[model samples]
Target chain A: MTNSNSFPAIDQDGYLLSRTDWNPAIARQLAQAEHIELTANHWEIIELVQEFYREFELSPASRALVRYTQQKLGNDKGRSIYLMGLFAPHPALLVSKIAGLPRPANCF
Target chain B: MKSLLCISRHSPYGTAIAREALEAVLAAAAFEQNIALLLMDDGVWQLKDQQQPIAGIQKSLARNLNALEMFGVDTVYAHQPSAQKRGLNTAELCIESIEWLDDDQVRQLISNHDHLLSF
Candidate 1:
């Protein structure tokens, strides 16, 4: 277990080495690594991705993430453009990263 | 689109094959292929309701299976005799729209698909 002072160990690719090592602080640190400043919008998607991991036991692929977001957050917040604006260039992978979840297995 | 069928014969959680099969199906569906899934033998256990995978050790196969329709893999089948032998009722399945088929129908299903992927 990592102490509260130091950051948790992450994989070579910057994902948390252990899901248990994650917390809000860790999420903030992770977002920093991705050069993202966490906002209410970011937190909302991050929380949604974490919930998606909890329910599905796996990270959502890009398409699945879009559909899931649409289902839960409605068409307005669910579109690719919306998710991209928050976590662009690969929202599924990037969101999962900031959310402290594993890189989506089906993403690549 | 060419029709593809994925046949899963392993029990979920015993190994990763069951999950792999499901992933393949979902991937194919995502690509807009005409795909169907068949859960036979111990694979029928995948559909059994109330799956509680040990937290952090495994993921809930039932919940993952529930996402089939959302992924566009709408045609899912379960072997009726396999479920009966295991004492699983249709009502107890995690996914509600799964079509149950017997031996002869299973044969027909096999012959109907253009390609068969067995896991």
Candidate 2:
């Protein structure tokens, strides 16, 4: 397991300070910090958000996150409840943090 | 919800205004507000498909605009004369479903919105 010191710099909210520092290993560690375990379903959404960041060069707010997921992953996996079940409390914020994306601009 | 019309009148990468305008539209849409984008003046350059910003220096504005629809910003109006004056080819636009408007139509479009934000 990667030690706490082995992780890259993060913000107060635990999001990676630099997107380049993100990797599957770092993502797994970040998810662990949020008390989430890595599952294939979680990885799907994680990779999708990272792809979203790469395409738009901006982190998505909740609405955009759901819509983008729907566009890419189909409705079964794109609903807010589905996402909230995976990341709970606040899906957009938590998912972005775990994916090493900057805090979503319109998350609040 | 009040309808907002965001007019983007600057070229992408020339300054931050164009991108800022786009962000405001997206932000409003994220809030579930009804928002539309109007690209006029130099803003027509934002839809030009052939953009490759310096990797670390600037993000691609066209790519940013692509997310507008997904963000619930479905209406995108482009000023035809501004595009013509700048010699932007329709074939070169990166986005689809652009509502092209002449000057009179643009004025009418301006009148149709409950709020107007110019960039």
Candidate 3:
């Protein structure tokens, strides 16, 4: 049975399922690949992703994601670079991964 | 086909970067291109919940963001770390929930997009 409240769903066979479920270990690995030091901000991003999944039922694109956060938090803390810094320190890749959408088609 | 990505890293009230970013995105969307917007660092401020602009400010970005959907520019991303740094949590803001991408992912996003414009 699928638990609507849970982030990852399970099938009758008891297998975990999700579009992109990153465990803490996996998250850590990805963070290491990006040379980002795990911090409260990174965790906040993860938490927001989980929340977004619950509200939208789908991973949001980059643009929508920022707007969403800004709405939730006040402007004092929602700047693009600060948000970008949490994921990797680089601005572009941060948007791609968080949105769970394909990388922008023309950044290169 | 032409694609445009506008990056906003400033707040709504201070300076015009956020407002300009919104204008650029709206303009690109009007062109009927695939347009995406990203907010990292201070840019996340553009999405804050309720902003009352002082009388002297030229314009406000809070209104502009609310109209992104009208312009067909939907994709929005924000940095989680930056939000926390500023003591702004999700519930406190007014915009939609943005996806949080790390640095590596940001690089990939830039590479994939056809055009990139930052304000």
* Each model's total of backbone clashes: 0, 0, 69
Ranking by DockQ: 2, 1, 3
Question: Alpha-carbon error at B81 in model 2, in Å?
Answer: 1.0
Q: A73, model 1: CA deviation in Å?
A: 1.2
Q: Candidate 3, fnat value?
A: 0.00
lDDT of 3 at B68: 67
DockQ by candidate, in order? 0.43, 0.74, 0.02
**Candidate 3 displacement at residue B27 in angstroms:** 0.6
Ranking by lDDT: 2, 1, 3
What digit string (tens of lDDT, one per residue) describes model 2 on residues A1-108?
Answer: 445578788888888888888888888888888899989999999989999998888888898889999989999987999999999888999999999999988777
TM-score of candidate 2 against the unseen true structure: 0.95
Candidate 3 lDDT score at position B55? 39
List TM-scores for all candidates, in order: 0.89, 0.95, 0.49
In order of TM-score, best first, we have: 2, 1, 3
The digit string of per-residue lDDT tens for model 2 on B22-104 reads 88988888889988999999999999998999998898898889888878888799999999999999887888789999999
The candidate scoring highest on DockQ is 2
Write candidate 3's Cα lDDT for A62-98 as tens digits: 5555666666765754566667667645443443343
